[model samples]
Target chain A: MATEHAHVEEHTHPGPRQYVIIGAILAVITLIEFGVFYLEMDAALMTWIILVLSSSKFLLVVGYFMHLKFDDVRFSGLFFAPFVIMVSIGVVLMALFFNLTR
Target chain B: MQYLSGIDDHRTSTGLDNRKMLMWAFLGSDVMFFGTLIGTHLIYRNRSLSGPQEEILSIPITTISTFVLLMSSLAMVLALAAIQRGNMGSFRFWTAIVCVFGSIFIGFQMFEFAEFAHLGLTPRTNLFGSTFLVMTGFHGTHVAVGILWLWTILFASYKGKIHQGNSLQVEIAGLYWHFVDIVWIVIFGVVYLIGAYGAEGRALEEVHHAARAAGIG
Candidate 1:
């Protein structure tokens, strides 16, 4: 009985309405991104804003659309571990190249 | 509704289906792959000694394609939901929408590439051209593969192979489709918006003024 309950929980997912709401959120974030892109401001500030907005969209898609939020934590552990490492390496590589190019 | 026997394969030691676990592992590796590509692009940004730079990029058109891809993701998830609910009609409808949206995105990319090449920004144009084209070209190829994959699953549905019992197939495809969408979200930000900022003539004007001040031109 406990195994059956676990199996049921594993497959539980949001319905169409919830998915649509999440989709709408993602769309609005993209529009905001477009608006932010056109604004005149400090380049660094603009870059940070774009990063935050894009990260939000990324998390939403991974969490909701991909069901990573409600699904198994092991899956998240498997994916995010490499994800964090690569992002760090990517940033470090950028820093290295920028310095060399400068 | 009849349940698929293999929906949740618990035979594994981790109590997870091997197929889904493998997909996640593949995606994890793909994150590193794209991270390297994106990092290379950023590293070489603005290093093009000559040839067309970011100034020639068409932001408005690319933004529309971004929006289309985002909507296709929504359609993809909806398709999966429809299948899980045993609604084949809705599933077919949304699945076809995803294919159409995917094709439209690819069409926009083709137009952009043609325009850029016409302006002399091929892979050999400069560092910017090489990195930019390679990174985005790989992404476009992934999107193309995803469209074909989804279409195959959709066709299989009609043959009675994709019922609620076997909706895991659709779920797996949805995962791949969403991964493609997320990759584009990152590309749109890092490559198009941030990379092209002020390159739409502002940066060129700045360069001209600098050259004039320095008495070079």
Candidate 2:
């Protein structure tokens, strides 16, 4: 629902350049994620790396490709709140699984 | 009501949009479901209940599938653009393309799951099985649902429910499709690539830890 500037914008969409940038960033994030497998770190850092990378890609795709940026900001909230809660539950479930396994 | 400002693209009736809003909320809750499921997968991944486990995720195979899904998103969005421009022909063309791409992705997943099951990894087996099957299985279900939605739209389009003026319908469907793709992006990194690359995950983790140790994180 983002309004254009009275018929003077370059493109209706965010322009192809933005998509390219998004793609490049995603590729970099993917590389970083895969890159983590080689290091000798404790469990906490390993988890943190993946979490940050995943969250970044998630935000970018939803905000850009989904046009949540152009659409209502409420849509972003709708998408985000669940995401955070789900991630919290994800953390709890993983921890619970660990405890149960032990 | 004031919140309607952004999404008000001149729909005669928001009946569908309201329904979509509700469905999105439900899907939001399902987010928690997948999160828990993936969490379980990660937890048991290190434990390795003694079998061909995450080792068989096949980064190359999943990478191909991921590419397919990503392209499907592009197609779906293009379909929306077509519809918005009031070109029914192009809309139908692109929506059909979107459906095909989505189906291929789902079929590949089925094949992968079958392969894993054949290799003795399953929810019935152990903890790894539980998390792996549940998380990916839910994702597969979502894909199936998206396909069903696409096919329905296709049928409706042929029957006249989806038209050039109704690009928003396609947009909503595209939104769901993209959400599914986004989820896979994470799953790709966490489950497939990390599970596959083997060394980068630790390396990146160590780098982060070093940063945090240096108070940079």
Candidate 3:
């Protein structure tokens, strides 16, 4: 990417071709996730596989298509910090609710 | 440069870009809303006394909707591509199509939820129903809001206000659209697939009981 950045074109950027590439990769990951589900794998393994594949697609869309990776780490931290906190609160809520009747 | 770039590059929005900023703020709040709903749905998943629940979630059907949404994201990118290429015709066409597909997904969701309600469960029914509806409903509202925004942008395109200068605004909106797609992917896996996992557990239990009855492997 740094190498590509060095040869930047001036006067009206042609837009990144990476969008098409990312779309293809996302499709492949989706296919793999579906295949894993119908296979003879255990539930735990299947869950992990789906989670990993989904996260990969998520990051690719965010980092590349959103231009978050190139723009600023501050932007990444700004969005992701809140995202993590929200998920944590969710986990705590789930635990509390589950333990209520236990 | 050898390329004759049709799109303008020096153009930008004023004052931190209101459209982009608004989208970010809304998504931040939406993440919390959905997180809470999904958490509860998962927590009380086993609390259903007579569950006509996620076990009823059909992947092939949901998968088709998911596929539609994924394709919408693709069209969103293509719209951005069209704008960059200075093809307003293509851009408008694609954006309109994206809106159409988004609306279709939401329509299917309405049907699915209606079916869920017809099964004698709803948001006011119980813990399970409340969480299930809220979690999926929150996502549904986002899709509705997106379609509304697409209509506004489509009009803006006709008025010439949404030119290449403010393409960043559209890009930010696309990011939100894609994030919704990603969330649906997780929901399909966790809420639907793992929900199906519960059914798989029941099937396994039935097989075990049958084996014991037959005294066979």
DockQ per candidate, 2 decimals: 0.65, 0.35, 0.33
What does candidate 2's lDDT look like per residue over B34-141, in tens digits? 777777677667565345555567765676787777777767776776666667787788788878988999899889889888988877776766778788888989
lDDT of 1 by residue, B1-217 (tens): 1243554443368877777788889899988898988889888887777888888888789889998998999999999888867799999999999999999999999999999999999999899899999999999999999999988988988898877766777878888889989999999998888888878676677689879999997
lDDT of 1: 0.86
Which runs in model 1 stand beyond 4 Å of their true positions? A1-11, B1-10, B205-217
User: What lDDT tens digits, residue by residue, belong to model 1 across residues A1-102?
Assistant: 434743574468777888889889988988898898899988899889989999999999899889999888998987899999999998888888778868
lDDT by residue for model 2 (A2-102), tens: 23331222244564456556756766666676567556676567767787878898888887778877765555677689888877777777778778878
TM-score of each: 0.93, 0.75, 0.80
Clashes of each: 0, 14, 0
Query: How is the predicted docking of candidate 2 categorized under the CAPRI scheme?
Result: acceptable
Ranking by TM-score: 1, 3, 2
- Per-residue lDDT tens digits for candidate 3, residues B1-217, read 2121212222135313345555666667667767777777888886766545555566667767876887788788788877765788988988998899999999889988888878777887777787778888888888888888888988998998887655665777787887788678778777876677647567566668879999995
After TM-score superposition, what is the CA distance of residue B157 in candidate 3 from its true location, in Å?
A: 0.7
Against the true structure, candidate 2 reaches a TM-score of 0.75
Sequence-dependent TM-score of model 1 = 0.93
| Best of the candidates, DockQ | 1
Winner on TM-score between 1 and 3 is 1
* Candidate with more favorable, higher DockQ: 1 or 3: 1
Candidate 1 has an fnat equal to: 0.77
